[model samples]
Target chain A: DAGITQSPRHKVTETGTPVTLRCHQTENHRYMYWYRQDPGHGLRLIHYSYGVKDTDKGEVSDGYSVSRSKTEDFLLTLESATSSQTSVYFCAIRGLYGYTFGSGTRLTVV
Target chain B: GIQVEQSPPDLILQEGANSTLRCNFSDSVNNLQWFHQNPWGQLINLFYIPSGTKQNGRLSATTVATERYSLLYISSSQTTDSGVYFCAVPYQGGSEKLVFGKGTKLTVNP
Candidate 1:
């Protein structure tokens, strides 16, 4: 939580526009993750990176993609933002203590 | 992938009260962590207990891996404790990728 930072704490975008959320970590943790939280679904994983340039899709990855070119940064992109994709997104890093999370980005699509 | 279910989906408690939250997984897991998402959407790590028990301040956690369940206890709750509690587990293999439960929302009133 202390080392991880999520950009644009709040964003309002058009339904068809593309959106990219950035996650930067000061801690050099190798594993990074992106997740979205909704009312009924709770938190669902979007994607994760085990190392720089090594990423994998999660259960709810269909509308999302991620890139990790550096150990300190993981970016989540929505190719085409949809109203349904409007939710709070969180970034996390695997640390010695456990998974440390970011403050989260609140995105709204209209 | 393991399935995580948290009980008492919504809880209300008076200040200084105590409560117990339960998490039941569909399978055995050696990696588990508890998180608290505050009203501001900041997720804070509470415990990284995979098994056994651990206590911090007024919060304690116990995980019985063999029984595929974990319990989180909060004592002397305060209004600041109002938030959503989550328990997450490894998705598969030994990866840090996690699958989270829907969450248990707690509202502590003064």
Candidate 2:
């Protein structure tokens, strides 16, 4: 609850469709990250933004993309959703103490 | 990329019991954190113990950087403590990009 909010807490979509998730932060933290959680795989980094308009890919960047055009918003997009991408997505903001994570978005691809 | 490993992949305990979860990293890290994913799928930041020890309420964490391992101790566990506990670390001298372990799933019964 560190001033972070994720939209569409739960989503279900068919394969080959486009999907986008939004993460909004009020703390104006300098770093933002997207991660996915799955059974047996833990949490895998998908993408991260160090500053406004500055982004970097993570270990599991394939089939996904991220954009941070403003300090308060970061977006994760799936160009063509697939069942393999079904998982709980989490967004985090880096603070001096540690990271603050959003509640998470449960996305299912049918 | 640093590799993180968590032990005792699954744990079950009764109320008032105490348990320890361990995380080992393959490389040196400057940042190490512990998180609790509640049944509601919210990732709660538990600790940011890069070194030394820190405690909050019924939870305490110790990180022995020299040994490349960290331990999270939960005392007087409750049914509310049942969820996944994850330990994550970042590569040496890199941005705060975390690599997470598979997590230790804890199930506490009343």
Candidate 3:
């Protein structure tokens, strides 16, 4: 709701292919996060950025990487898409009062 | 890292029923947020309560930071409320990253 947007709402990629999901925020938040939601695994953090060019791995960071070249854009890259990575990816920005999430991007690996 | 646990993995209720979803955190925190994910895979932030009580229409939340738990109460639940409810706490007190619970799935039938 904080003017956050996710691109490529849905995507299907071959295994071992590289895919990138973009999160753009008009508010220019400093903290951004990437999470994957699976049926039983819940929402697991993949990576998060505290500032431009500063990122850290989360609980499930393997196979995923993130980059924040600017204050309004955060990119999540799947190094080599796998079946396990097929799920809905959410991008969020930490707000002053709470966290705001994008519409989410659903990715499928074939 | 902090751990979050939600009770009643699934619940079914008639439209107009009232329900309480609970979240327990492993450590005390100054911030706890609640979210609702609809069937369309949109994550909506419902509450940013770290302590005390906050209400918005038919939904309200209370977080007891001292006790390390939070409660989300929904009154007169509607069919549109059928979704997954999640609670998250900062990784460590006020870290930028958040740890989320598996979530409580609510089904509000008419």
Candidate 4:
């Protein structure tokens, strides 16, 4: 509940299709993060944004790209969806007290 | 990246039981956090204890930065407390990117 809201709570896409997830925050936080959670892998970072138009890759950045044109919006894109990309994606914002996470988006690639 | 290991990967406790979940890290961390992923796949931040101890209601967390470990205690647990508990710490370079452990799956039964 870090004032973060992720769109398309659940999505099912075909292989090779392009998919994008949006994370919007109202807190005007300086940092935003994208992470994917799988069965064995607790949670793996995909990308992060430090400021407007300032983004960096994370541990699992392959097949994913992020854009942050505004401080309140961060978008995660899968150029081409794959079966391995099916997982629950989470958006987090760094708060003064701690980090806050959204409800998450569940993506399924068929 | 710092390595995080959580003990008792799986734990089943009866209602009203008390449990301690441990998270051991391989390096010093500037931020340590505990999160509970609920049944609906929502991540709820429980604690952001970089060091020292903090308590909120039935949950308490302690992080020993010197020892590179953190502990979460749940008292009088209820069935709603059943979920995967994750402990995350930042990468060695002090980046906001977090490295998460596999997590401890706790099942509270009536």
DockQ of each: 0.88, 0.93, 0.89, 0.86
Candidate 4: where is the Cα deviation over 4 Å?
none
Residue-level lDDT of model 4, residues B1-110, one tens digit each, is 68999998999999999999999999989999999988888889899999999999999999999998999999999999999999999887677888899999999999
Residue by residue across A1-110, what tens digits does model 4's lDDT show? 75789999999999999999999999899999999999887899999999999999998999999999999999999999999999999999999867799999999999
Worst 10 residues of 4 chain A by lDDT: A94-103
CAPRI rating of model 3: high
Report lDDT (CA) for all predictions.
0.92, 0.93, 0.93, 0.94
Error of 2 at A45 (Å): 0.7
Top DockQ prediction, candidate number: 2
Model 1 chain A: worst 10 consecutive residues (lDDT sum)? A1-10
| Candidate 4 to truth, TM | 0.98
Candidate 2 chain B: worst 10 consecutive residues by lDDT?
B91-100
What tens digits encode model 1's per-residue C-alpha lDDT throughout A1-110?
57889998999999989999999999888889999988888888899999999999887998898998888999999999999999999998889878998989999999
Quality class of the docking in candidate 1, CAPRI style: high
Fnat measured on candidate 1: 0.91
After superposing candidate 3 on the true structure, give the runs of residues whose Cα lies further than 4 Å from its correct spot: none
What are the TM-scores, per candidate, against the unseen true structure?
0.97, 0.97, 0.97, 0.98
What is the DockQ of the complex in model 3? 0.89
Clashing residue pairs in candidate 1 are none
Tens-digit per-residue lDDT, B1-79, candidate 2: 7788998999999899999999999988888999998888889999999999999999999999999999999999999
- As a whole number from 0 to 100, the lDDT of residue A28 in candidate 2 is 88
Candidate 1 lDDT, tens digit per residue, B6-46? 99999999999999999999987878999998988888999
